[model samples]
Target: MAETATHSGTAVRVYDLHKSYREGAHALEVLHGVNLDIARGDLTLLMGPSGSGKTTLLTIMGLLMKPTSGRVELLGRDVTSLDESALPALRRRHVGFIFQNFNLLGALNAAENVEVVLGLQGVRGRAARKQAMALLDQVGLADRWSHLPDEMSGGEKQRVGVARALASQAELILADEPTGNLDSRTAAQVVDILRHLAHTENRAVLVVTHDLGLQEHADCVVRMRDGTIVEPHDGVAA
Candidate 1:
């Protein structure tokens, strides 16, 4: 029930978004009426400085956080007023998140890590394990399916994290600094996989990164500084 933004073929649409954090007596405003549209088959990268609010916007789009005002539409549904209790289920059903640190469980093997996510989505037992292995294979990690986090290279662990993110077959994927910890070569490979999820699988992919290396892979690039989109961009050369 806020002001709207124009868009098409968008899996996620953000309109007039604003966010604030309470700091004692004052509310520190972060996002300043940002608007964006993420297409189902495109990889959108949001780049900005440390306090530019790009990550805040990404979290809001992923349903991991809510804004102070404005609207967020995911797959065409306005989720601005969803109850806190309902968020987990909604996120489980529609969203997948990839983090910079490759947050796999050190104690759990790669397949087991993915299985845990499937279990959250009501997939369990042998079925969950089978699906997890298949996803790992898709990420080209079939050989490392049973490796623990400590046993695998940084790239392999991230690939497992990617498999886990895809475990629930989510429609929207939000990655925060996903390549920050990897070397240049490995980072490109990971970006390629993210693009595959968007282009090949037709999922909506939004990545929040400061790395300019990602510019070439993005279908659209939204640059932010001081909490607003400040530049023009195009997607897919069309």
Candidate 2:
């Protein structure tokens, strides 16, 4: 990690994390004291087979789900202890999310969908629209900014989702199976965009995926099994 003068220097740090869910009469553990540190400008991929807790870990990191016990520091703040209202504000300011489903509003056009996030952050009307358009342009969807989700192709919709994630200017991005539904070519394009966001924009990106095709694009690969990170290795191939 790079040393900096600012307070929120480190992008992400987790220590002794644990999570459990209720299954029947038993408490099923999903994470077993996981520890991780992801620096800014890093693209880390968490991979494993089904039931491996990759998604569980990703959700916890994104602050969408609370851990049973642990320390989660994002940009230097101990977010693991934040209250519900503060957590939302913190997430809005620091984290962006991309999901496999695109999660676009069919009723809104691409630009409008991106604008929603800005609006929530107190930006409104023309200013929000302009910022949304700029992000769409960045994602190669300038011409399709006014198109609705149904009007665009699958890849185009996904691109719009990526643009929305970037529109917030968030420091950390969490993506869950972002390419799960696309063709190989489209998947490559999405991964390329994500990689550029991390390397060029100096953002910390963590992706949960089972796609081996994405291995080439990750800087670090973390393997999970049965609710625990088994090992983490550099992306250099064997």
Candidate 3:
């Protein structure tokens, strides 16, 4: 596979993906020849019970883990065979991650937290601050920019996480149970922001969760079971 970026608008494509781990003398398979596409401008939900390999698939798609055997294309470039050193830069350039714990710096305020990500993208000093403020405003957290993580509510902190993710201008956003720490109402609000980012900003957002309330907001809901996709959603290849 070539590493050329084609104009396909696809954020990620995995073909015949598989993952396995050696436990004692037995090789335990965690993924079973999975095939999927997470397209740009879509909110895709990966849902299933515990130990279903959802996180395994997500880690591979996010370029955080290598599959046992598969082809992974990100932004139309074949990344499965890239060197480990090369993947960090590529993943940093294209992928933004949202964690369930909100992963904010306890010492930094909202704007500073977001600016930290901009710094990783080589935007620093005044420019990073300005961009961070703009992103906080976009996420409806402009007023909370000066508040520390402990001072903010769970929902507010998650919104800041979203802003930080956007600071990198990432084409693909991988969210792992983004709303797990919030109340129902707050969870819905966060999901709304994710969906809006996908539809309006044309970012491909893939969320791994068992939250049934999020189903209605997703463009496609993919269900996995025992390391394999059991039901593929309509309008999306899985």
Candidate 4:
């Protein structure tokens, strides 16, 4: 990976990225010198078949895993060299992660679920509550603020997850198979919200998914095959 700094408008950049795992005495390479840039104000899609290393790349960019070799810059900061202990704080400030499963607190309502994130960022008391409500409203869930995860539909729960992600004020949003569990119509609704976030809010959103339907809403589409990007980021917004 190059040691160059990430550009101002870029949210995440990876250069010459490589990752490998030790299988007994052999090193099995997963990512082969992958290079990509996720720009601000764009919803990017990372699509690939199983074992193509999409989740590996996403986890590394999200600062949850270390690259075996390469450079990772997040929001213009060179995070590749940061200490492991420091990554969580940096990720909390700059990255919001959404998983395939709705990782919500079943006991907490939609607003409280989002409020928990604000609280972690030190915005507590009435301020956290107010901001959480505003975020829920942004995801068109204001009326469902009091609903728990079980009380909501799959799409509604995902919206709460989206609102919770936004509560952190994260500049980069990384989602893994966000629509994997929803029906076609519900998936479209969720993707529309994500597209709106990237365009209107100017946040960089990267979704790792197999759903080609999302391509219509993506600002950039990256394809991976056999652990390397076979398709370039051809559709990125200028």
Candidate 5:
């Protein structure tokens, strides 16, 4: 995959990031002195095998986990030291996430599931519902807005998850194996949506995956191995 054209603005910056967990008497480092910059409006793919720190890097970028050491700057704000109370607001406003499992509520309809995230961000009932419906429509799930998770196929559920991620109008999106559960055709569709979100909507997208087929849609690929970035090709880690 070719690197996305670098924009003048920086979307994310990491300085010497390090993360470790205590495994008995010794510390197991998951990420070792990592540094990266994600340009605004770029779609970057992170690829690696298990235990390669790809997911660790993604989670840190998404502010879902704090690094043991190092600095993270998101949209020019240093978030490494932010407290938990402030994190929720910051993450909700500036970052979005799409998990492989789709993570939708079994009891809620498509639109309702999207609305739940907006509601957490303080968007009221009617407004949240409207925005959720709009996002669902944008993701080609308008007709399925009333369908529950169990009533939908794997592809449909993933689409609903994508809609929910967009509900907050976040500038940065982190997707972890987003298409891992779908058929080839559906996976392609999902990848198209992600590319559209980054290039068309100007959102910075980082996707962590082991699937090489997604490389075609990525602007850059970053590949990691043994807790460190081993290769950076055209901005995709490979």
Candidate 6:
């Protein structure tokens, strides 16, 4: 697949990113000078083992977490230096995230869950409800809008999460282990939907997962070992 950037040629760009956490008096570095570029109209898989910093990279690109040092550009906008107050609006308009646990509210039905996202984008009332149902339909959850999270299967809930994330029509999608809780068949279906979003909708999709089965469907594959990118066969040295 060509590295097409539907939004001026690049969807999300990260430069020399570093992240650290304090465990007692010791500083544990999670990401070390990680650099990456996600292009529109392609499904990019960020694959690695546990504690490989793939999720850390996803959170940073999704603007949910700040990096210790480095720059992040989304749709050519410099988001690293922006204040916390500015990020919410940016994320609302530009980014959508799909989480491993689905993250759907237990109290809210599928439609309501999706509607909440639309409300943040200034769409509300009957209009938001209608749009949410429509998005749910697109995610293959039609006629199930009134179903609560506990009532649905794991795949169904994740589909609802996908619908919720795309309710605002955000161009950049960051999915972290979206299929982790799903069975193999269900996981493949979810991956198909994500690929459709990237290929047909011209959206940029970054999926952080350890599911090697997904490699066959990726347009571009990025492998991370420890805190950095590496070849698929490269082993981390102690």
Give the alpha-carbon lDDT of every model: 0.83, 0.81, 0.87, 0.86, 0.83, 0.85
- Candidate 4 lDDT score at position 162: 94
Q: Per-prediction RMSD in angstroms?
A: 5.1, 4.1, 5.0, 4.7, 2.4, 4.1
TM-score of each: 0.92, 0.90, 0.94, 0.93, 0.91, 0.90
Score residue 217 of candidate 4 by CA lDDT: 70
Candidate 3: RMSD to truth = 5.0
- Of 1 and 2, which scores higher on lDDT? 1
Clashes of 5: 9
For 1-238, candidate 5 gives per-residue lDDT tens digits of 6446445466777888999988999988888888888776777888888989988888899888899999999998899998968887788788999989999999999989998988888997889888988899889988999999999999899999888888877888889998899987788788778777777677788888777887887887788888877776333231
Residue 142 displacement in candidate 2 (angstroms): 0.8
Give me the runs in candidate 3 sitting further than 4 Å from their true place: 1-8, 233-238
Clashes of each: 0, 0, 0, 0, 9, 0
Say what the RMSD of model 1 is.
Answer: 5.1
lDDT of 4 by residue, 121-231 (tens): 899999998998899988999899999899999999999989988988789999999889999789878978987887777788899888877787777788999888888
Candidate 2 ranges with C-alpha deviation above 4 Å: 1-9, 233-238
- Model 1 residue 229 CA deviation (Å) reads 0.5
The C-alpha local distance difference test score for the whole of candidate 6 amounts to: 0.85
TM-score of candidate 3 to 2 decimals: 0.94
Give stretches of model 5 more than 4 Å off: 2-8, 233-238
Q: Write the per-residue lDDT of candidate 3 for residues 1-238, one digit (tens) a residue.
A: 1111122378898988999989999999999899888888777888999999989998999999999998999988999999999999898999999999999999999999999999997999999889999999989998999999999999999999999888887899999899999987898788888878777788888998777887877777889989888878332442
Worst 10 residues of 2 by lDDT: 1-10
On lDDT, the candidate that comes out on top is 3
